[model samples]
Target: MSTPYAPPAGYGDISFVELVPLALRFLGLGLKLVFLALSYPFSSTKFSLKRVLWRQFVRAICPPSSIRQLQFVCPATGVLYQKYMRSLPNKPPVISENIGDGISLHWMGPKTNKKVMYYLHGGGFVLPAVDGHFYMLDWWRNEAKKRHGIDFSIAVLEYSTYLIDCTSSCQLSKARMIGLINFAPWPTQLVQVAAGLAHLLKEGYDPANITVVGDSVGGHEVIFLLAHLIHGHPAADVLNLEKPLAGAAALSPWLCFGTETTSWKQHGHSDVMPLGALNKWSGWFIKSRTRTDDSYYFEPALAPAEWWGGLEKVAKNVLMAGGASEGMFDDIVTTEKAMEKGAGKQVKLEIFGQEGANHNEALVEFACGDAPGSTNYRMLEWLKEVYA
Candidate 1:
């Protein structure tokens, strides 16, 4: 029997101490919304009224002031995803396995399914999986069959978020604990994702039949996972695979944690991601690091091109996509070029510049209760071709 699924400590519901800050955040959000509404006509043509509103809503809830502050308001992803899965009618069989070490893998189909897409969600590594994540995953599962006649399961890994540093006391002020809070630090996510892959391998699934996929930070994790497979991270255990996986895919993968590119300056305002949120989240992730020379995994764009030399040995193929209007466009292109230089013929990249496209466009659409758009169509088709 599998271990009973348990959510992270403080999985749902906010504490009394968080109420004041949460309330103040809401008040500030209201003010911002009012300002955006009044200034709508003067805003850039790059953003539609709907897109602008959505961006502000995300920005308001995910503030740059504190990581813990965002955690306090956002629902814990594991429990919420579980609830959403249960509520789905005629959905694929759901299997919940606590693969140990506080990491949970929620399989959308049975473990015996030969083909799998190991999905890692993106929320700056701080926010948990939202309803949109599940909705989009389920939609893709159905569409994969309907559109391409491919049968596959999706195993969504609910890795722990970086809430607070393990050594920091709860009594510390949010300001004092900004950079010091290290709960669920660098190697923690890497370890958990690798464990999820290991579990799939141990269950008799061929590495050649599995494709790892992620969005934004999840995409960042996918890239590093490939690097780790090639170079190996000392802090994490290794996976013993018989052969390269079928493929890997990332949508708007946050390649570099910094915002110093021309794309950032061009698309920051029009995109859904707030510049402040990126700054704060990247700072928290970097500051929580326990090592000094960890940029090979954390900052892949800045790493020497030789670091990804054996990526073709990790996966048979790689598919990376980004929206031309997204701030991470330049970084995505840079990372792609570096990987291509090393891995040669194994890398394929697509940049969609359709009107209104932004970072992780597929996910953003699902969040707004919109149907899957071009990016989703391309990803589903790519899965079919790779698995062919």
Candidate 2:
């Protein structure tokens, strides 16, 4: 008999700590609405109340920083660790081996020439590691084995971050360095991931059998990988291969930086994210990476409309997913719009709309059946169609 599914504990219950962030987000949105209302008459564009309300709603539900904390802290390092980290009662048929440099390969089913999935974890470009995502990872692996009936290998890339003092430089005050390294101007981590994928491709894995998936900031990494693969190295000579991937998937991706999206503007209240908080985090990120200016890697959305032109022909299989009820809906929408406008028919978008589902909830739904409508199941089905 199949084991009864239990929702991860700590998160199942609401707490003051969680409420604090939510309250702060609401407060910020309230402030922004007030300011926009007062400045609308004198403003150039008529203040979009719908946009403002929508953004505010998203802020109240899917605060970016809060989502980050849940992934890195609550699941990886908090009291709920047991619920999320415990090995499945029934171990998956696949074998998982950890390759060094924060990468791991989980091979499922009998060894055969089949598609490989490169899964990247997202934590606002900061927290969480492979272990934190084991539950969802294992679930996907098993599902792939059962549905595809072909061996599947997952290359989990461990990318460097500026927030964790893991690097030799333990200096936490280096906000500029942290920002540059953590935000990563060139998607250096994605290049490394591509390197792993290339290794598999060279080792008998077909180029057409590779699918790259990432959540949150990792979702942004998918675009970075495609952009780099198509356009060549923008910042460094990392990977020289020009092979096209089978497909790419991003969940609740943070595509733009400092744009007036739902998250950036705090729903409609400029005060939600607080210029002070933004400056503080931005400064910290920049200092951690030891970068003086962050415009190069930090702002991909601001790139010219023709930036994705090179990828038009090469990137034929692209899957972008986000929750309509989340603050990142605008990010996903805008990104899809950009791709549609730039790449024309090259990109394929699959947006999963879960009413009342937040950002973290969207991810949880991808790996676990937390959100309504069995979101993870739907996503896996989509992967099956793409890879099959």
* lDDT (C-alpha, whole model) for all candidates: 0.75, 0.53
Model 2 poorest 10 in a row by lDDT: 1-10
Which residues of candidate 2, in runs, are more than 4 Å off? 1-86, 89-113, 130-132, 144-151, 160-191, 238-243, 262-283, 289-297, 312-314, 366-375
lDDT per residue, candidate 1, 1-388, as tens digits? 3455545554434566766777877798889878888899987765556666677788777754455566565666666666887797765445777776656777787777899999988888777777888888888888888888888888888774445542354321332212111235667777778888888788788999999999998898898888888987887788867889899988898888778799888998767878777776777676666666678788777877787787777788788888878899889888877887877776554444434578888898888766678888888888887786
Give the clash count for each candidate: 4, 28
- Over all chains combined, what TM-score does candidate 1 have? 0.87
Candidate 1: regions farther than 4 A off: 1-3, 12-17, 27-50, 165-183, 346-356
Q: Which candidate tops lDDT?
A: 1
Q: Supply candidate 2's per-residue lDDT for 201.
A: 56
